[model samples]
Target chain A: MKFIVEDAGAYLQIKVTEARIDAAIATPFKDKLREIVVKHRKPVHLDMANVTFMDSSGLGAMIAVRKSLPDNLAIVLCAMTPNVERVFRLTRMDRVFDIRPDAIQKEANE
Target chain B: MRLKAVVPPKTQPMFHRVLDADPVVVRATLTDMRHRFARDVCDDTLGRLELVMAELMNNVAEHAPVATSDRLPVIHLCIVRHQAGLACALADDGVSLPDACMLPRSLPPAIADNLPEGGFGWFLVQNLTQALCYYRASSRNYLAFNIPFMEREDENLS
Candidate 1:
């Protein structure tokens, strides 16, 4: 349930440190991330590079976080590993969220 | 007496484990299972196998019959590699699996406002597996399925 959060002014950049988001930690992971997003009141840029595995419970947690936010606010998932991405693709949750291959580099581009 | 000729192990890899029905235990078993067959299978097929196993095992853990005895259900898992795919068999002393789980299924509707947070586990299992079958006998539930290798254009070349 570890995450590195950075305030990027307009959005919160979160890097998930855990290697696997499975049934063991999905509930707490959802609760902690939800609290972080609710407190910031801004868009989210989730860096998922370290998550090598994610089960349906983990996917459920991600969906719960998405549902927690207001419609105007967005959560952009980034740098998904192949295993994590497979669950989303197989279950069609890929259509629900915006997933990127790399972490947001809004500052570097500017 | 004549010296015995040396014999080699079986050509295909196999894995077996018996453990309590718990999420942490299931995760550890899956990790070990992946390492056991990682060299034998391609990434796509292995990924599919892992996902299906996780979904099945976790479903058992999540739905442990609470009103029964306080002991946790025990699960026996066995996997064997074949030329066509990986064959997986799991038996658990948990509650009988719901009939709906084994039937053909579809994903929950993707409603825009109220998105589905659950109900995707069995759907993924059914989608990724082949020849899936289940039966309950003598207070134990048994499930068996095959995860076929993904078709590759270059397969014939190799």
Candidate 2:
């Protein structure tokens, strides 16, 4: 799995360049997110536009990444495809993280 | 005078495949099936089927213990068309769930202090499907369930 990281001024944007995020890439994805969180020490926005599918393992990885961050830090997710967003809603993780329709718009508004 | 009549069953598999239990193969098979079924089934039904299969197949890939020999494991999946919606049946030659760990029917509490890293697979599956059934027989585990075609407004997060 490949993730392209960018500085979005207010928050760091990480776009997942994979069609599926399951057990095959969950561990590595989580590890990379953690590394970015520590290095940037800023709110992170995950752009899941390319992610067409996510399983329980992928959901667990998101939760794990959220837990690994400091109490004050936030991990926001944005631009999730319908299939990926459905997993978040079904698992109720949508309530846990700050999810938005577009990261750039969210940042500009804030 | 006597009369006899026969009616075919309302439910029958529209698509079925048996594939290696590898994660890559599972992903590819599901993607192909989703596209093929997209035109036949409603979007909600297709999404639910994809979610259920992804979790089930991933579970098998991650936890299913390897057999004593070098041969790889395999799983069978079938999607049946029903009068109301769709039905799925999956069978795998992997290790069965422990006797103590029954299928979870409720969502895990969304607590921030003690968020769970895993254990949400069966919960989502149960909520998304109807007539859910799981049983182990002849050294293979079988899971079968039905999903309605109507739109599920409750699934929307907003």
lDDT, each prediction: 0.89, 0.79
lDDT of 2 by residue, B1-158 (tens): 66667766554347889988878888888888887776667676788888888878877777756656365568899987766777789999887866533455567788878898887888877778888788999989898888777755324311
Against the true structure, what is each candidate's TM-score?
A: 0.93, 0.86
Once superposed on the true structure, which residue ranges of model 2 sit more than 4 Å away at CA?
A: A106-110, B1-13, B99-104, B151-158
User: Candidate 1, B38: how far from true, in Å?
Assistant: 1.4
lDDT of 1 by residue, A1-110 (tens): 67899998878999999988889899999999999989888999999998998988999999999999865698999999899998899888898899988866878643
Highest DockQ model number = 1
- TM-score between model 1 and native: 0.93
Deviating ranges (above 4 Å) for candidate 1:
B1-10, B152-158
- Pull out the clashing pairs in model 1: none
* Model 2 chain A: ten consecutive residues of lowest lDDT: A101-110
Top candidate by lDDT: 1
Interface RMSD of each: 0.8, 1.2
